[model samples]
Target chain A: MGEWSNARATSEAAGIGAAGQVQVDDDLALVARVQAGEMAAFDVLTRKYRERIFSIIYNITSNREDAADLTQDAFVRAFTSLSRFKGQSSFFTWLYRIAVNTALSHLKKSRMRRFFSFETINEEMAPGEIVDTLSQKSAGDHSAQLAELQEKLNEALQKLSPKHRTVVVLFEIEGLGHQEIAEIMHTSEGTVRSRLHYAKQQLQADLQSYLS
Target chain B: MKKRRESRHEVSGGVTLEQLLRVKRAERPGPEFWADFDRGLQQKLFKTVVDRRRSGVRNFFRIVLHSRSTYAMPILAAIMVAFGIALNRGSGDGPLPQAVTAPVDMVVSVEANTRASSPGAERFVVDLLNSGGESGNFRKVMSLGSINTPDAGSTRYVADQLGSVTGRGGVLSMGDSF
Candidate 1:
């Protein structure tokens, strides 16, 4: 959901520096509630995670339609399989596993690349400093230039192999630490870092026109 | 590779790959997207997940490699024990005890990796949570563990997890509705 977080949520900007324990504990408690036949608890989780689930998938597939569908499927999957979710990993991590696999499966099955449907770039989030420079560089058409840059970025991302793109999305875009991505991807931290490096190198080359 | 070069690019002001990628950060769905998302999820849960209970438990963890890697990973989905197991593993991150007491299986543990075995084989993998992984490169990583649904949709169903069909339910994506 949008802007949907409990009051106990840590500052999203601070990145859960010291309060991670409190958050994870809260997740476990919610997991306990949902396992106890509290459908509403599951709903709480869906609201908490749906946007995230959507974003990861959206970035991976580069197709808004597939991302939206896969996100719902991932949540529904998480809900139905609620009984199996032993709290070994954080619930969000568990949910993420479902989401990534869902996207991979979709990518594997359809193997059909459709027209890319990207989400709108939130104007507020765009770095004004960079936007201003880019605007001047691109003939002062600020919004249009940003939109083009957005498309080019998505295109560059979509060009990566699925695995590389997943790493890039998680590490670069998602801002997850290497160890966390390793655990989520079921790969080693080395692999995460390696994939991230290669993915970035490719992106850097592809978008050199903009970055340079 | 030089450590500094690997980390950042000093192009005058130096726009790191991470910063350039922030453009992707700017791309996010608005509230209307969430409203449709809830509706879609409720509908799919009603359809496919209910139908998957009989497809047989996933006997093996499909640990996809990056076109390069050694060995495999196994997750607990099939052969994942049956019964109403309690998640009373005390509060903390423990490996999920691989037991599926249907209707009420509580997986509470401090271990990060959940274990699952392949029947009639010695191979096992910690691949239970791969169907979808990673917090949506959250526009914001609001680690709100205690979450509540404000007008969350309703459609309850029971069945096995969506292992293969995680991508089957094709809901019409939100178009220009962001």
Candidate 2:
């Protein structure tokens, strides 16, 4: 059994280099090739990032149509501004910043559409029932509930300000570590921890119903 | 009914409502999710780019008009200068005008007189040199004697000097002249 385990470990260790650790690797050779005007490299990057990028937009917007639109916009903007991407950070992190700012800009423009939007949502619905409750809620209610929740989240997010939301998003949803999140957000580990702590407390209080 | 379900799940710290909601959201389905998402994205991108292009064209025209408004004085001045030159030639003002040459020098000095009441103010001998160098290459040396702060009189003085130099087809030196 020990020998078998040793063999498995050797195989896993062998998987640590270049093509083997493709997912964990942050080297954006594909992006670099795209920067050199390689359309095919860009296509590879697009395919790799599309689903994950779409997932982030979907989480924030919660509307498939809008999220998809924003995702495509994010990719196109990334493509156009690819020359400006200095690669001080990984390409993915830079792309994530673009995705977030694009989504936030969209929300800002649609702010008037968000007024009193949360009034009719059932704040008492359990986690499992929340989406279903939303789906069953009036077509108008679906939009209203989503808008309200977003407004609340935005408010809660704003309370911690820019620094905290970035850390929370990078760490919690994106599953990045303190070190990784620190690198992406460009702060020390201590700052990341403080922001994360404050962010969680704010989220817990504001999103208390969502958590319950 | 939803409230009651929500209340049941609101127990202290075990697993927050938000986490459960997240799990539930993960399970929520919109059939043909990926396909629909792709189609929607393409349409939105097309619309946004189209809108930006349209606005960009409008802004180009607006910018051109604004620039013309801003440059009306300089343009008018050039036209007037041309007209004046034509009139002067018609009236015969002593064989047109002579080539103007204005020599300038920047003087800088440090003196150790040590007689000034304020310790900060040290009297020092200075020699200055000012001449036309490429603007990009021009560097500010020691700044003393006459400092052109952004007072209105100073600004107008500089503007008049510049206008006179350009009017007489003379080059303007930025710093001290030797």
Highest lDDT: give the candidate number.
1
The C-alpha stretches of model 1 lying farther than 4 A from their native spots are A1-17, A135-139, B1-14, B48-178
lDDT of 2 at A8: 27
For A1-212, candidate 1 gives per-residue lDDT tens digits of 11223311332333554566686788889888877655556667777777778888988898888899888878878877877878887787788888988998899987865667888888778766556566444454566667766876888888899999998877666666677678778998889889988888899888776664
Candidate 2 i-RMS = 17.2
The true-structure Cα RMSD of candidate 2 reads 20.0
DockQ for candidate 1, C-alpha atoms = 0.17
> Worst 10-residue stretch by lDDT in candidate 2 chain A?
A1-10
Output the lDDT of residue B116, model 2: 37
Q: Report residue B110 deviation for candidate 2 (angstroms).
A: 68
Instruction: Estimate the TM-score for candidate 1.
Output: 0.61
Candidate 1: residue A117 Cα off by (Å): 1.4
Strongest candidate by TM-score: 1
